[model samples]
Target: MPIVYSEKEASLQEVVTIQEVDDLLEWLLANTDASIDLAECRHLHLAALQTLASARRKVSAWPQDEAFKGWIKPLLTTGE
Candidate 1:
């Protein structure tokens, strides 16, 4: 799985596809206090990006890919 969820965090690895968005949202809905770790994320589906933006959780770590991280970090981190 691209996203690994524990009690209070989601670790995003490699690529997070559109198919993972639903489960990702479900997990977010279930755990409003959860933080996200995107240190390993290379890419994220548009839907997944939107879902994460809407969820607006704390980002524990940004992506290792500088360009990717620069693009989405604001969208994900602005409100926090």
Candidate 2:
């Protein structure tokens, strides 16, 4: 699965396509202080990004892919 929910870490591992925005949103809403691990993420859908952006959650680990990191970095830091 692309989005792996970890109860112990209170984190979500974004590995591939985070296609279901509503599911992600629901998860985010349920889990406060949820951090995201994008170390192995290949693609993040726009809606998923929107959910993350709106939630303003912490990023526990960044993606290994530089381009993806570059793209998401601004969204993560701009409001802070």
Candidate 3:
């Protein structure tokens, strides 16, 4: 399972399947100001990426792995 929706106060970890993207998006919409930590994430499908890109919420951090860090570089730089 992928660590999809995460915040300082709340967290949602589940398989990064197509069906879970909607729930993740909804969670992000509801907690726009929350600081999300995506350090433990494994894989994110295109659906999840789309939802994340469209979301108005702010993520605090990305995974420490170089590949993951590079992938989410734009998001990490854009402050909330």
Candidate 4:
């Protein structure tokens, strides 16, 4: 399942699987007020992360897992 983060009455869904990224991206483009939250997820495929990173989307929080954090660190804190 994807992780969704809401801030300031806006919500963003972050997809970590290749299968769902496309759909999520479509949704995101249509709705720019939402925010993505990847901090609670685990086992996100690299390709999915890459797509979000390339788009420069910012995540609301960091995952608690160190490995997961390391993997997504670049994408999250880059202010993207």
lDDT per residue as tens, model 1, 1-80: 79999989999999999989989999999999989999999999999999999888899999998999899988998564
Candidate 4 Cα errors over 4 Å, as ranges: 3-15
In model 2, where is the ten-residue run with the lowest total lDDT? 8-17
Report clash pairs, candidate 1: none
RMSD after CA superposition, every candidate: 0.9, 2.5, 3.1, 3.6
Q: Which ten residues in a row have the lowest lDDT in candidate 1?
A: 71-80
CA error at residue 76 for candidate 4, angstroms:
3.4
**Ranking under lDDT, best-scoring first?**
1, 2, 3, 4
RMSD of 2: 2.5
Top candidate on TM-score is 1
TM-score of each: 0.95, 0.80, 0.67, 0.68
Which regions of candidate 3 are displaced past 4 Å? 4-15, 75-80
Clashes of each: 0, 0, 0, 2
lDDT of each: 0.93, 0.71, 0.60, 0.60
Tens-place lDDT per residue, model 2, 1-80, is: 67777642333345444466777788788887667777777678887887888888778777788998999877865353
Q: What residue runs in model 2 are displaced by over 4 Å at the alpha carbon?
A: 8-18, 78-80
Q: Encode model 3's per-residue lDDT on 1-80: one tens digit a residue.
A: 45434454334342366877767776777777765566666556778767776664456556667786688657545554
